[model samples]
Target: MTTLSIYQVSKPHRAILQTSDIASILKLLTDAGVPFEQWPIRPLPQNADAAAVLSAYQSEIDRLKAAHGYTTVDVARVTPEHPERVALRQKFIEEHTHPDDEVRFFVEGSGAFYIHLGDQVVRLLCQAGDLISVPAGTKHWFDMGPAPHFTAIRLFVSPEGWVGHFTGNLLPGLVPKLDSAHA
Candidate 1:
């Protein structure tokens, strides 16, 4: 299930609002200029390769690519056992922004995106079949849980791939990560 939780950037541990309702999530994010929606998803067999996963959404991929003038598309996955999982998680968990839109479709597992907009921050818990497009220059951070496990399809306008410009603000360690029990 998809979830949306809102919190003041000064107190991320306490959620001002939380819900699993899709419509509400869309409304809240849309109002903030972030695109959040669900796309069709069909189950893939165990251990499906990246090519196979992309093929499953060929039509959607083609449409988005043409519409956005995306020069490259790639699949990125991180598992609990991945050696660099800790480093990878640490790298993105800090506040940052991209020069181009950060687009992702969660094909498996889940991840949390904390988007800072003005006085409050929106923490979006995105699951499989969820599509999130963070507009370019939006301040945000991502957490893939402590024991990461997710495969995502990433679309890029530029072939250079993800380039994040980190913001010095730490949000004051107020943000909460996925707990070990959940992981």
Candidate 2:
């Protein structure tokens, strides 16, 4: 199940709101200018089950299909053992650009997503069943944790491939981390 708990950047104890309802979650997040959704999730996914996770997030898939005409869903899982985890984390922290909209469906585990849009900073705690859509050109960073792990489906619209537009900003390691209780 997808869970949402909003916190005031200043106040930590009193939650702005918390809920497991997808519609309401989307409404509040979207109203806050945060793009999120709930897609059908496949279980114990790996190997070929990756495709199942992509299909689970139909709305996002549809968006990609219509906007960029992306085909061939690739389901991927990352754990503490993934060799590229360190490099990928470093790459994501630099705040890069994507040729197509960045869409990810969290099939397992949780990760913190910080979107830097001008003066506003939106931090999202994305867990299982959570669907996140980051528009192309948005600057952002994702933290999977010290033991970094997750199962996600990726969508690409450009045949040229996903490219990173590094801002050269030291954004990753400097960002504050969220506690697991709230994450």
Candidate 1 residue 125 C-alpha distance from true site, Å: 0.5
lDDT of 1 by residue, 1-183 (tens): 788888886666778898999998999999999987688887899779999999998888898888878778899989999999999998998899999889999999999988999989888889999999899999999998789999999999978999999998968257667662321
Give the poorly placed runs of model 2, Cα more than 4 Å off.
1-25, 32-34, 45-64, 178-183
Q: What's model 1's lDDT at 179?
A: 62
Which residue segments of model 1 deviate by more than 4 Å? 180-183
Candidate 2 colliding pairs: 40-56, 97-165
- Give each model's clash number: 0, 2
Task: Give the clashing residue pairs of candidate 1, or none.
Answer: none
TM-scores of the models, in the order given: 0.94, 0.72
lDDT of each: 0.87, 0.66
Candidate 2 — what's its lDDT?
0.66
**Candidate that scores best on TM-score:** 1
